[model samples]
Target chain A: MISVLRRELLAFFTSAAGYVLMAVFPVAMGLLALFVFPAVLERGASWFHTKELTMRSFFLAFPWVAAAVMPAIAMRSWAEEYRGNTFQLLLTLPAPSWRLVAGKYLASVAVLCLMLLTTGVFPVMIAANGGWEGGPIFGGYLGCLLLGSGYLAIGMFASSLTSNQLGAYMAALLACGTLTALGSFAGLAGSSGALSSMVRFMAAGDHFNLLAAGYLKLETVTFFISMAAFFLMLTALGVEGRRYR
Target chain B: MLNVEAISRSYGRFLALNGLSFSIGKGAILGFVGPNGAGKTTAMSIITGLLAADSGAVHLGDDEVHATPSLVKSRIGFLPETPPLYTAMEVSEYLRFCGEARGMDRQQLGERLENVLANTGLSARRNMPISTLSRGYRQRAGLAQALLHDPDLLVLDEPTSGLDPAQILDMHELLRGLAAQGKIVIFSTHILSEVEAIASHILIINHGRCLAFGERSALLGADGKERGLTDLFISLVKKRNP
Candidate 1:
């Protein structure tokens, strides 16, 4: 497992796709948080009343950003191997299939962590502004992590569906998009009561919203964990299907 | 060293392999020759445990290939036609990963990497990224990775398919050298000359079945009784189709 992880890390760093993703994603977020959001805040947007408000905005915006960026990083995880014909080589190895999938998934999470770390300036700015609530800030960060995990799982499932990286990227975008859109007033969850609850349960926003509000509900955490596990199992089953079918 | 019994594989309505069975003795160099869509790759894939057989069993030594894939896979090395390689990684890095994937420890991996680099004549390009290497070098790197764990059996699918004549000869010689070192080498090729150059045993497959399997000399028939290997291959294919 360590060997696969090491190799995946090397590949992620060496390829141009990896470098572009690592460089572009964080810079884009930094520009958004430091410049764009502040401009919006300065435009008499009084709803963002306190440091908690600013953190909530940041947390709320993160899922959309990740919807695009995570796919760029994770879509190639397995698809590239299939395109390059390396999947056969990988499968023939003595290691189990789960190890390979897990290793690649972790490598992608590491890259996402690096991207999140780059946005550390936002938290610092919030702290500098004073009146920041420690609970919500910590909760918001936790929410982001969980959201990232769920996105990574969806991206992995997309990767397993096809050998084409572009196809994987598009599929991940669509799937994550639907999940993200479900949280909005215009989306299915907002207009319907029962669907709102179900969508709230299914969408990353439901858990993230609680975390952003400084309420870490056990049910919400369980929701994200279950979703992540479900997609990961699907990815594994997709991989296993290749050998059997 | 390797045994396949009544192995069959299918994809939807298409049959890839139909009750194929064969075995290779220790240290033997067997050439799997067939035209396109002849189940050569499907058979090799099943043997190496990359693809599962629908209804059959493969035994590497005493272990069942599918039932105990890790055990069988640990003792086998395989290179597909496209030479599965991570082009982003350096030659040495990829080889080290391949070694570890085969259950090698750090010390064993380091030693084996050095040995395979020398064996595949890739010592000079060890640190070069695979994407930067020439086609011939890429194939050599693929061969090096497969042989890195020093497996008892090697399954190569069209290893020299796209190489120039000079590189093809080099690859042939490399397989011969591995066989001489007591490794069971089974390579697939459409080129009859390549088979004649290195293989002691020949298995001619058509459609999805093995049409003939025996010593190269015997399969070619008695002197003047049959034509060259290519002619034999053509006639066998025709006979099967007819």
Candidate 2:
């Protein structure tokens, strides 16, 4: 598994894909935080429009941003293996299926962390302004990591389903979009019924919303962890499924 | 010894490998020949544990491949038709990755890496990225990875496809050397003469059924005269198709 992780990281760095991805992720997120979201929400002249110095606007745009970028990060994970005929080599190696899945998943998450790390300027800016609290800021960054992990896991599973990278990206985008959109459904978050609560629990964005708001609930953390694990298992099963069929 | 026992696989309504069974002992080189889409790749995939046989199992000695894949896989090395090269990585880096992924210790991997690079005649191109390699070198890189682990069994599909005659001869010599070292070699090729040159045993299949499998001399010289594989192959295939 460590070898796989190292190779994956090396593959990313050695290819044009990694540098292009790094530039695109932060730039896309920066654009949204600096221009798109602030303008759409009519906050102020910029993200700093209000007197409050928080990353609230940034976290707010995270699910959408992650939905777009994490898939791009993961679209090539398995699709390239299938297209290049490398999966035949990989699957035949002595490692177990879970190890390969985890290795690839963690590599994407590592890339995600680096991508998120580049946005350190946002938090530093929030702190440099002298009115920022560490709690919500920390929670929001944690939320972004967790939410991005979930998005990437699903994206990897989508990639395993097809040899076409574009098709993988679109499938992942649609899946993540639906899960993120579920949070905005009428009365879903506000309702108290068991069915609505269940639906609310299924919305990945709702869990991210809690962490981004500095709630730090255990259930929310579990939701994100389980979401990542569940999709990772699905990706493993999809890869194994090819062996028999 | 490797034993593929009554293995069968199907894709929806079409049968791919239908109760295929074959075995080879240590130091034997078995040539696998069939027409295109004749389940050569599928059978190779099943033998390597990359694909599962629906109703049968491949055994390496006492352990079943499907039952203990991690254990069985460590003893088998497979090279598919395309070579499975990661074009972005250097030749040495890719081989190291393959070695480590197979769970070789650091010292063993380092030693084996040098040996395989030298053996495949890829020492000069060790630093070159696979994407920059010619078709023959890429195939050599693929064979290098399979040999990296020093497995007891080596299964290659179309091991010399797209190579020039000189490279093909080089590949035959490499396979002969591995077999001399007591490794079981099973390779598929479209070239009947290549099989006649290197294989001690030969298995011919058509439509996923074994038509003939025996020692090369016995199968070819059965009637007190040497018979060409091309004539035998054409007659056998025509019998099945017609």
Candidate 3:
């Protein structure tokens, strides 16, 4: 497992894709947070609350950002291995499929952590702004990672389904996009009715917001963990399936 | 020592391997010669415990590989036809990863790293990305990865498939040296001269069946038969399928 992680890290960093992703993700976020979001929000009276310099805007925006970035991080995980014919070598190793998947998953999470680190400036700017309390800031960071993990898991699973990186990326984007879109529709379903409640319960945004609120509910944590585990298991099965055929 | 008994596998309606069986002691090279789709790769995959046979048993000395694959896999090094080289990784880094994947401790890896690199003549190119290496070097790097953990059995599928004559000769010498160290080496190849050069024993297979299995002398048939390998293979395969 450690070997897989080390190799994954080495592979990611050495390639042009990893650098481009690491560089592009933050820069795009900076442009949005620093310029576009602030500008657009200020122009719309209905978006007044969104224009406020609070952590909610940043937290709210991340799921959308991660919808793109996480897939980029994970698209090549298994897809490239299959295309290169290295999957046979990997499967033949003494370690089981789960461990390999776990290692690769963790490696992506490590990069996500690094990408998160680059966003530290946002929290610091929030801190420097004085009016906002610290509670939602911590929660927002937690939500971002938890939400990113779910995206990573889905992307990893998607990668395992095909040998084409573009196909994997599209699959992940579709899955994550649906999850993101569902959250907004649930929000529109309006806060009180059972129909609204059920959609809210299923949507990732509700859990992400719960974490971002700083309450740290048991169910919220369980949802993210379950999402990660479910897809990781699927990824393992996808890998193991190769030997049978 | 290795024993492959009654291994069979099917792919939908196609039977990839049909009750194929062979065995070899240590310090021997088993050359599997066959036509395309003859199940040579399937047999090697089963022997290495990478793919389970629908019905069969594999023994590495005393332990049954089917029942305890992890142990058996640790003892075996398999290089598939494409070599499984990660183009993004440098030779040394990739070799280290293979060593670790085989469960080699840090100290064990350190001790063997230098030798494995040198054995495959990849020491100088250790720092270069595998993509930058020539096809010959890439193949050597693949061989280097397999040799890292120092497994008892080395299974290679078409190890010399794409090599030029010089590269092929280099591979023959490498296989001979590993066999000299008493590693059970089994390689599948289409080239009869490769089998003629390195393998002391040969198994000629076709349509997922073993047409013949014996030492080089025995494969040449009884006293004074002295047929060339091409002639021998043609006659045996023709006689069996016809």
Candidate 4:
């Protein structure tokens, strides 16, 4: 597993894709947080004009940003192996299937962590502006990591389903986007019913919202972990299916 | 000894390997030859435990590869035609990954790494990225990774498919050297001359069934008959088609 992780990390860092993604992710998050989300939620007021020194704009815009960036980070995980003919080599290795899945998943998560870390400038800027409490900032970063893990897992599972990276990216984008979109519809389902509650629980945004609000519920943590584990297991099964075929 | 028994596999309506069976002992080079899509790669995959046989078993000595794939895979080395290589990695880095993936200890991996690099004539290029190497060197690096664990059975699917004459000769010599080291080497190719040059055992197949299997000498000329592999192969294809 460590071997797979090391090789994957080496491959990622050496390729232009890593640098491009690192550069693009923060720019995209910045545009969406300061420009796009504020335009949508505040009727043309930018985050700076909100009169608050909080990272609420950034936290709120993260799920949408993650829906794109996480899939980009993970789209090549298994698809490239298949295209390069290395999937057969991986299958023939003595390591268990789950280890390979975990290795690839962890490598993507490591990159995600770095991408998130780059966004630390958001909080630092907010701090240097006037100063705000650290609790929500910390919770928001934690929520971003957890939410990104779910997106990465979904992307990895999508990658295992196809050899074409573009197809994997599209599938993951659709899946992650749908799950994120669910959060926007929870209020329209009439606010106080089993259906609305079910939608809220199933959507990743609700849990992330709690963490971003400085409320660390155990169920919120469990939801993200379960989401990651579920998709990772599915990725392993996809790999194992090739052997039986 | 490597023993394959009644192995069969199918893909949708196409039966890829139909009750194929053959075996060879240590120090033997088994040349697997057949027409395109004759289940050569499929059979090799099954033998190495990379793919499952629908209704058969492959046993390397006492362990059934199908039942205990992880255990058996550690003792088998496989190189497919394209060579599953991470082109960004250096040759040594890739070999180290293969060794560690097979659960080799650091000390053992260190020793094997030196030997594999030397055996594959890749010692000088150990630090070079795989993407920068020529095709011949890439194939050598692939072989080096497969040999990193000192596996008992080495299964190569068309290892010399696209090599130049000089590279082909080098590959033949390498296979001979591995066979001399008491390892079982099974390689697939369409070149009959290559089989003639190195193999001690031969298995010929077409349309997912074995056409012939035996010692190269006995199969080439027996029952007071003598023929080259080409003549035998042509006659066999003719007999099957006509």
Query: What is the per-residue lDDT of model 2 for residues A36-151, given as tens digits with 9 covering 90 to 100?
Result: 77877874457656556777778889999888888988999999999999998898898888899999999989999999998988888878878587888889999999999999
Candidate 4 chain B weakest ten by summed lDDT: B233-242
Off by over 4 Å in 4: A187-194
- What is the fnat score of candidate 1? 0.91
Of 2 and 4, the candidate ahead on DockQ is: 2
The digit string of per-residue lDDT tens for model 3 on A130-174 reads: 646677887788888899999999999999999999999999998
Q: Looking at model 2 chain A, which ten-residue stretch has the lowest summed lDDT?
A: A43-52
Which of 2 and 4 is ahead in lDDT? 4
**lDDT at residue A165 of model 1 (Cα atoms):** 89
What's the ranking of the predictions by lDDT, best on top?
4, 2, 3, 1
Model 4 RMSD vs true structure: 1.7
lDDT of 4 at B110: 100
Q: Comparing candidate 1 with candidate 2, which one achieves the higher DockQ?
A: 2
Best lDDT among the predictions, by candidate number: 4
| lDDT comparison, 1 vs 3, better candidate | 3
When 3 and 4 are scored with DockQ, the better candidate is 4
| Per-model TM-score versus the true fold | 0.92, 0.96, 0.93, 0.96
lDDT of 3 by residue, B153-223 (tens): 99998888777888788889989988999999999988898788889899988889988898987887644
Assess each prediction's global lDDT (C-alpha) against the native: 0.83, 0.89, 0.86, 0.90
Which CAPRI quality tier does the interface of model 1 achieve? high
Candidate 2 chain B lowest-lDDT run of ten: B205-214
Over all chains combined, what TM-score does candidate 2 have?
A: 0.96
Name the docking class for model 4.
high
